[model samples]
Target: MKRSTLYKDELIVQIMGMTDKLQRRFQSEGVDEERSWMLQQTDNPAVISFLKRATMMMLHVIDAIVALEPVNGIRIASHLGIPRGSVSKITRKLVQEHVIQMEYLPDNKKKIMFRTTSLGKEVSKVHLALHRHVNMNVHALLNRYTPEQLAFLAQVQSDILNTSLVKEDLASIKDDPPPAAENPPEAMDMRQAAQEDPIRDLLDMLHQLDSANLSKAKDLLQVVFFAGHNG
Candidate 1:
């Protein structure tokens, strides 16, 4: 095999191993707390949605402050490439939820600005902690590899992340689901099964989409053409 091809395979193995080790360590060290947190999010739709809203709010706040100087809902939505109505919905909900505080500009009654609350900051800390802990755990496991191996793994991960974005960007062009084959037995069975167990069907659809995305990504990254024609 080519040197680069071999190196990529080694990196994939290291990443898989690192992931396995982190999962095991989590189970061993903080299983109870982890389980509790997972259950809390899983059981409470409000809490889960709050986390999602909090993250969007934090990013909007950061981006608005950086780009627009002083940001209101309109500016936040513009920066995020979302609709103003949606931004208003999220901001109003966040304000009512007390995760953010709004301030009106003195010159204009209609103009408003936002700042994170203490509660919001606390949630941000938890979000950051989760990111750091997971990354550190994975990196610690990866440290067994040599510096060269680590560099190769990092490059491979970077490529994968980029390809994932490409896949998502391409997927966004779709307006509707693909049509199923009519009167097919496999389709009938799948339809019946999906009707019986919607959640499982949804999961299987996601898995299939994920596989397609990765397959498309692999095809995108591979270099192949008729030798004389392209060259």
Candidate 2:
């Protein structure tokens, strides 16, 4: 292999390693323990119960409602770049948990709007503090890098986001023929299997992030990479 190709391969391996590490860290029991600690700080049974059951996506929906009270499901979906169906499902659960409630305009009784309840606000407050703590640490670590280094890192992130693998994988999946009845599940092609890759899902999620959130994500990645190197 050419020296450049070798270096590119090494970079790919490093990136994959970093992504795997992040996935493991997020899914680890330690994170759950930390969440449990956060929950213990609050005494409200409703808040505690809701927090315990809330997924990250659910919390994100609550945050959206907090920011955009009296918002409809369509508006929330547009704001978050998620599907309306997903927003509807999450909002339904949020209403059941009493963290969020639905409202209808007096002028249009059929129009549904959402807003956080008192318990929802409390949960939002706790989640906001959690985010603040994480962001503070990430920002402090990121501050150590010079502006040029940060700029280069940002460029790297952009390049990764614009990689062709994601496009090719998606395109190939879309162009594939439907499986024949005689084909066993194990007969699935490599391109079809690529659809199940978590990295592709991660890339899709990154693409959905707005500029501010993307910057925060880059900072968090830098922190994770720096910590990995030191450890």
Candidate 3:
């Protein structure tokens, strides 16, 4: 195997091990109130799946509610590039959780409008904080890289995933309901690509990074790639 490719393989194993540790920590650490609450919700499994799948959608929905006016299911689906049917299902669950609330305009009683409740807004803020945590961490890493290294990292990533994007398995939605809820749309699309290509599914998630963090990610990746070469 090429040295860089071999290093990437080892890196994937290390990351998987780190993820295993995080999973164990999350399971055992009942002291953290926030994580504790989320853990408690895992009893149903549906709640956990819903939150994981809808987090990005919720973030955008909350932003729309705060920055613009109230939005409806279609608006949310359109904004997130998912199916309206998905928006409907997730909004119903969010309403059940008392996270989002539905209302109607005075003249149009039939028209349902969606808005984030106080609880929903708080959850969105929490998610935003998690997003910022990664963003800041990557930026910190970028401080150590040169521009060429950053560019190379970006190029390598693009080259790796260059062949095709994910193809959604919509059929699974009908056949297997619960498991489908855990995979986000991006995940559904890129899963086969990652598996068949022998690349990381994480590269698919890189699209979620904000522009600044994405730039940082390139630099950080470059550092990892080159450091492997040197070592």
Candidate 4:
């Protein structure tokens, strides 16, 4: 095999360092309790300027709809691992913005589907361009590695997972613990509640997850991980 630009000894040392770093990062509960600076700063345009105006989760829904169109709300909810009701609300906003359209099967009459409109396609193109720009920049760092070395690096990264306790860890948590709700005596809607008290809402959701689906749930709730990491 062609050697990597990173020498084998250096590669091994870095991998060991990576494992230790991962363990320390995951073991800290204080990390999860802290608010994320990025989430708090809604006006930052370092990423996608247009996309930054709305909730970050909306982009995931928009991108998925483009890729899996002629799909319905239920499938979108499954794809994103969000509640069906939440997907319904997001899709409604997309429809209002002319980003997507709802269609029904002529034969079935009741079967609903979602498809991206022309405007939605334009938005998707911009979204995809942002991802491509970032990927190319990141891949520049890997260009010096031979194809074989890149493959080995991918394998090593995949082999380092330690998710066995995810379910055990999830199971140990209490069910549907009430949010602090301390500040708001008046009844605020779900959207306001989410924006005002993100952490409690997250715990309420985690209380509903289980070992069987926690991984998929986490895959979709990556913003949670980002919040923890950024905190």
Candidate 5:
């Protein structure tokens, strides 16, 4: 029984190793495809600029939704750790921008309800795609490690995730408005509310670059990883 249990544990670890490798392989290819898609979508300078601001804005809107009760503007902002006035402004802008919906509660005249619209959901999905693109590329090299190596790597990743890496990433995105007529300063302001996030910066970087950086980043990543230890 003891031997059987130990074998199962080892097997699980081995499987984890394989899965991690597969994840990296998938990400490497996926980042290539994602970059292609991003390029096609952002061919115009105006579009690229607008997307940068839009991406930042949408993240805060989503954060509010995830953290709050989908209640009205004031309450949602209050619950989600944002200023009520900022929430009200962003909510109104989002509704006008057609990324979210606001409906008055039936029983209450003063209270209103808010939720992501179909458009909002689509934007959110795109944002998620952008996030995944960055994550896969950044962690793609981890698959090269052995099972024991992967176990240690995973712990390190978890620790990093829980720390300021996230904050550092968010702070990288610049809040300056894009030069497009379609995307106004109001758009930039709302977006700036969430610009202090690392994930958004990573996505922005991925959206701006080609696959060449992917390989370089991967090689540099391996160098950094291997530099710390004996094996």
Candidate 6:
């Protein structure tokens, strides 16, 4: 076999191994560990119990309500790229947990809206802090790569998503809607894609970095990548 073909096969094996490791690392055990870490950050029993009971989807719903109070279910569904029915179910649980409360506008009594209660605000605060902690670590790691390297990584991720297998899966989903929900299969595919893609989130954060931070990041990357290469 050609050396180039051998190298390509090895690279594919390495990539697949890394993907499998990442998948395992973020499975249920990883989630429970993160949830435990978040739980330790607060003393309130209600918040503790709520955190214990809440799924990631439930936490996201509360976070959305905290960020966009007086927002209705449909808007939350759209904002989160989830089904309205799923949002409805999550909000009902949130209300039951007393993390969020239902409200009706005086002008439109028929349209129900959601707002976080004091408990919910506390929960949101903790969740935000947890994310900030995670982001800080991720940012520190990513700062080790130059902007060019980051862009290359993004392109690789995009390529993976655009592969024929993923495209076929998406196409099939559009034709065969799930039996449990009335939502269009296309919307479901989009939601699943959004959940699976951290590259998009990373790109957004990179774009949002202030000039001072961006310069600092570039300097760090130069030291980490360029300095090593030149040596």
Tens-place lDDT per residue, model 5, 68-150, is 53667766766667678877787777777666787777788777888876656555555566777778977787666644455
Preferred candidate (TM-score higher): 4 or 6:
6
RMSD of 5: 25.3
Q: Candidate 5 has what TM-score? A: 0.38
Backbone steric clashes in candidate 3, count: 1
Against the reference, the lDDT scores of all candidates come to 0.61, 0.81, 0.65, 0.66, 0.63, 0.83
lDDT by residue (tens digit), candidate 1, 23-109: 887666555454345334343454455564444345345434344545787778878888888777776776787767788889898
Maximum-TM-score candidate: 6
Q: Native-vs-model 3 lDDT?
A: 0.65
lDDT of 2 by residue, 98-186 (tens): 88999999999999999999988998888888888778989999999855456556656665666676455554453353333333344
Number of the top lDDT candidate: 6
TM-score of each: 0.39, 0.64, 0.47, 0.44, 0.38, 0.68
Q: What lDDT is obtained when candidate 6 is compared to the true structure?
A: 0.83
Please give the range of 10 consecutive residues that has the lowest summed lDDT in model 3: 174-183
Which runs of model 4 end up more than 4 angstroms from their true locations?
1-52, 80-83, 145-156, 165-231
Instruction: Kindly give the stretch of ten consecutive residues in candidate 5 with the minimal lDDT sum.
Output: 175-184
Candidate 4: tens digits of C-alpha lDDT, residues 67-106: 8989998999999899999998988887877778999998
If the candidates were sorted by their TM-score against the true structure, best first, what order would they fall in? 6, 2, 3, 4, 1, 5
How many collisions per candidate?
A: 0, 0, 1, 0, 3, 0
User: What TM-score does model 2 achieve against the real structure?
Assistant: 0.64
For model 5, the superposed segments whose C-alpha errors exceed 4 Å read 1-55, 63-70, 74-81, 141-231
Candidate 3, 1-231: lDDT as tens digits: 689868977997997798788788655552244443443444445445445545455556666554444987787777777888877877787788777888999999999998887767666665555557657877999879855455545654564455333565543544232322233456555643444642455766787899999999999998987777876
lDDT of 1: 0.61
Q: What is the lDDT of residue 126 in candidate 4?
A: 61
In angstroms, how far off is 44's CA in candidate 5? 14
